[model samples]
Target: MKQFRLHKVASVCLIAAMALIGCSSQGGEKAAPGTQPGASEGSGQQVTLSMHSWRVEDTEGYKAIIQAFEAENPNIKIDFKPFKATEYNTILNTALQSDSGPDILQLRPYAPGISLAEAGYLEPLDNIAGISAFPKDVLAAATGKDGKVYGVPLSLNSTQFFYNKKIFEQNGLKEPKSWDELIATAKTLKEKGIVPISFGAKEGWLLSLSHGVIAPASYSGSGYIDKLLKGESNLQSPEFLQSISRMQELIPYFPENYVGLELNDMRTLFATEKAAMFINGSFELEGLKKLNPDLQLDFFPMPTNDQKAVITTWVDGSYAVNAKSKHKPEALKFMEFMATKKFGELFANQFKRISAVPGVSTDDPLVNKMAELSQSSSTPYLMVVHFAEGKPTTKQALENALQGMYLGKLTPEQVAEEIQKSAATWFPPFKK
Candidate 1:
């Protein structure tokens, strides 16, 4: 009877939903609160909380985590919902606006999450237990402009190149340590009839993610974005514009009709051995493995023009509680569990992601190597984080400019000017 009761409770909380707003799936609507199989006979009612995240691939991994959490907190049940990355923000924003949002949500760290917090959609997590143990910089990445703690980071990820080890060996090439060497290496690979890189610009937003990894190392390492935020740097500056032009120079080595392809297609091109390298975040390792379990891969810091490479690192994702959640205590409980070292280890072990907790480290050597590279990460992709929070966001503006460039409709200068102009309402120098 006890076993059956536990299963019932799990079912209530772990219901899979296709659409977040409706909370309905192909399996039908979830069991309503208070009437679920394990609902208390009187005062101790069962509470089911929905957690929406963008990691659809991590669903099974999170289920294992959820099961562990359920065993400890029997009264509260958690349902994990996943969404496509490209459409996640739009769906989540819409849900929050309509008061139909989940109890917990995966937030894009920094400016994007802060924008929601400022709009009063997210709960302040100041009182959550063990939150103080998190690294200050990681915590600050999820903090709102108002100084309130809005989320707890899920993992640290950096944008870098994942190169095929076998491909490098076959070509007798060593990993490039400088920008010039990187170009020369790519040129050599192209001459050998191998696609040097797998990149997809069809979605447009990839320009931000891809370039965010390169721009910092190329221009001024981590200090560049900081300067841009402080009005010390602007998109029109030669250093910043040079990064854009550099991307153009390297474009020829990418898969043909690269802009017409999607990320999955590009990954396929890499996985099948047609491409020698793929630039993405550390989070992509698991997906890449699934595509080709035997494909040997390793990573290197994004090379810089001056040879002093800097990795682009930041708190990639965080979990925020919904301000309007009906079950705040339960939501807090789950988030508190997320902060525990036990949960951190579980997350890293299961998902192969680096934990945000101070003492926790991923057991995976590659993940640890990625962490080592982060020590040099200072400049983040600010337009994605801070500058473009309102009006035409820096991300949107920049991607449009990049798309225009891809189509040969705009020069690098014109693209930069368009980005500045697009962000004019929000960027200080361009404002009236």
Candidate 2:
């Protein structure tokens, strides 16, 4: 009788459990087609994705952007992690190689991004609905050699001269219209006990950035770049040598002991009003503003002998999905949102950068001026945009040679020769 009673109790419990499961099935929402087995869009199950970037300074900006994304996707959350810029590549590569990277990551533009895709670390974004909105040139930065788009272009960066408006006004200076005028302005600033340019050579990459700002106008912009790409010209060409010489000429006006200084030191000099001008990329605007909110800043492209200025512009970076991510659908949804105009506007307004997405405009007058300048006259940032492929890339060669030149270990001619030799070793057109 006791055994019979125990079996009756067991049967009643089983019936209760089945009734509860039936209630859940009848009342709960069904999973969306093609979704994961237990989780679906608006199914009340939340997912968190990890994202990594090198823009540590933009932490707050990204937080606000993520907040907006999360609001639209209540079931999804993003955790953004940014590492120091100098250390990011190594860290990201290590994580990716081990298949332990974040679900999404910020990619370096052009060859660097392509390499990640080629290594099978990145997912191809060809089928993403929003990728079609970007221009081909913009898309090229994140495209692999196999013709797959691996990321969404984030911003178009322009390298130029950023000047303190108050300093220029106090020094009785007008914007220079030619190379000679720029030299004269620097001389006047130096005479007034002001550092004419807040520049440094400690970091090799900045040398390339400075070159992008100063060289394009000297080489006649895209025309010269095309010649170099086709094997019609080399880095040792007179125009290219002239560009190298221009960098040498600016050394006298640089901050004292500039060779020992890094990017932050250079920025401090300018932001504190200890220096009159700085040659840097448009991306520095937000950081400079954050350093000194009262700073009065403006920018101008470096001018050529012919008095025409061409902005050196390139796609700065992109956001890519990791191929090893377990949450590909959710990560892809975030990527699709990033490619939208809404995200573009949010990015531009928050970061004060020129959005790669078309039709996204900024209210900041200075940023607007940059956008206008880009549209009117621009050239690809030569080394990074075109010659950044192969072992010991031309970009790397130029950066190293430029650093040597700054330290008086190499002359402009020698720097040019070294770069030419490096490019010839791997660049197909140069080999021909």
Candidate 3:
């Protein structure tokens, strides 16, 4: 798995009770004492270091790089544990609670990391030498209220609208530039029996992202985002509603099992040619191309009501060391290697996503277009349901609302109420 190959996202029915990551890590070469000034003093000090990361199936892809690290530092060996995509978050939390977890972890920025940071599972990064080179915005992201950095963001992957070039050409359609065009295109695709949009709203968070980033950015104008951030505006403003209303109107244009799909399933449907377009982050490009090398995939800015569409950035992966790790310095060294310009290019060019580091040319024609369209991205971890105890609530409310809307159980006004309730809980103002 060269890129993120999240094969399938199983039903979230058991999400409440299930621990994430079904794979157990075992059977890797182990050694120790080959690293650090003092650790190396003991010639045969064996440290069978095991670590956990989300979606660990990238064994073969990470092979070359990890092997190089191991070869250079002979005494330290790494036992890599891969997490199943569907169960990663829950399992990672469980592992982090116990002292027996992996020494390092791959964390999501907009999720429930504050709990772990406060629990003292994560190490601070203020003194890390290479911290300055990381994306400034993303660097700010890993900083928690405890005044310590919980992680180091590796790449910034923005979300957008992915449409099939061949399909657009065959239908004599151009990429939509405004909300009206998007709706018109959906209507056209519907007549051809193609699902125009593919989002697993049944999973809730994916649907929220579409509504949160694309909808708001398109209708209210970019200034609206800053206003909301400054508390001059709230999500329930007319602009957000207008954009969300347009998104909701497309319920009839998605796949048949829209009520039963999740993120990975929706991507598979698009990759297998079951849908004409998909809206998602950049992590999927490599795996998508692998499935169909000649698919002619091109993404365009999500059509907003505004003349200029604003890009919402989501930094995909963040790396953090364990607070209790005996080898903190080496871990920072690894973080340094990951933050360099070299890693940024490897990430962007390798994964076909936006890079977080400065000075990295997204000069490749396709990547350049994505970069050009990405105006700016900000950090707001305090909001977004995927962040904490708030997720289950959002998932329930959103899943119920969308599923109800699709099934004609809920009215538009009713659905709006349920979403607003959740947003309020997640975005309450600081009371200092």
Candidate 4:
């Protein structure tokens, strides 16, 4: 069996510092672009490259994936290093500033990726052969303002409701076809002494995610987002305010003291069957399974009043090469491999995620259903995909405002006003 090792964040920093010190001792210079540092074709020289990511939970999955790559390229070894998601941005920024970052790094999607590319921290991959495998919209997440592709798109995530199949069967519940039916079902579940929804508001990000799933249909999904982006509508508009109000409507169905609970608490409640439903991303499927391997689960999109389903989708993140790396040639080789259908299949099969590469399909029935929902009737995740380029990103503003609304410090109207005010401060469209 192929083998790979995982590194903690502190060890990753120490290893990087040691590598740079050893290079100095050898008087090593940065390799020219497109040139291999020490190894060449059949040269028998070994090279090790470091990769950094924010997914500490994906260690096993990445270990297997990296093993496949290492098996194919025997002379190249990769040290897969992952940090806590909450600290990754700061760690990556610090490493980049000191020129001690990993050869390959995971980048946050959209505006954050563009920021790095603009800062010259990432190598441009405009001419990479594998980049042609992705569509223009998918590539947009990692493309810089200068029109250069800076990373390989990894996964497309859909936010929806994951339900406990066993509980639904026991309660004689079927998937809700309309908003009213969904409310009725939640009421029925709550009457039976079961938590209708496993959700928490302690982390501001989770509130934003929950809003993404619950509120899209209220404002009519992409139709309204387009109008908002073009200055035709504002967050304080009636329809948008209704969207915020919808989140408040569902507050009664959430667990007691949910505002004090965090993500892990929410996941535990759902995975252990303490709750009947969970609203989250496609990325959570494997995690839930790991928590309870025997858990019987399925997912569905939130239904609209008109009976249409609306799933919110976004490119989660991507993999990029550090512009300062001495292993540019080998790092590019790995990037090429990541863009291949082979790697795409491995990623989808192992992680149960929706791979961004075109024509890549998953064996997981639930993942397949998510893809179908996305293709049939889906909207872009509004805040991160469009309004995150500005300072006090629309996402952050909405999250904070929602938290305040939940705490009884703000009303739905006030929440909408705060979002509009924050956006107007930096968002060009809103400035109009």
User: Best by lDDT, which number?
Assistant: 2
TM-score for predicted model 2 compared with the true structure = 0.90
Q: Report per-prediction Cα RMSD to one decimal.
A: 9.8, 16.0, 8.1, 8.2
**Rank order by lDDT, top first?**
2, 4, 1, 3
TM-score of every prediction relative to native? 0.87, 0.90, 0.81, 0.90
Which model, 1 or 4, shows the larger TM-score? 4
Better of 1 and 3 by TM-score: 1
Q: Compared with the true structure, what per-residue lDDT tens digits does model 1 show for residues 1-432?
A: 000011121112112200112111113322333332333524567888999998888998888999999998888889999999889999999999999999999998666776687677877776678888775556766664344577888887778888999999999989898888889999999999999999888987678888787776557664555555456767787877887887788788889989899888888998888999998888888778878989998988876766677676667688988977877667777888998988988987787767787677766788777766665343455455445444667677888888888889888899888766666666553453
Cα lDDT, model 2, residue 197: 99
- After superposing candidate 3 on the true structure, give the runs of residues whose Cα lies further than 4 Å from its correct spot: 1-38, 41-48, 56-59, 362-364, 376-400, 423-426, 430-432
- lDDT against the true structure, per candidate, is 0.74, 0.81, 0.60, 0.80
Q: Which stretches of candidate 1 lie over 4 Å from their true place?
A: 1-44, 428-432
lDDT of 1 at 261: 90
Candidate 1 vs candidate 2: the TM-score winner is 2
Per-residue lDDT over 1-432 for candidate 2, one digit per residue giving the tens place of the 0 to 100 score: 000011122222212212110111112333222253443466677889999999998899999999999998988899999998889999999999888999999999877776776676877777777788776667777765445678898998889999999999998998998899999999999999999999999998899999988997787667777676568898899999999999999999999899989999999999999999998999999999999999999988878756788888878779998876877778878888898989989999899999887788888988888888787777778777766765777898998999899888999999999988988887766888
Give candidate 4 misplaced runs (Cα > 4 Å): 1-42
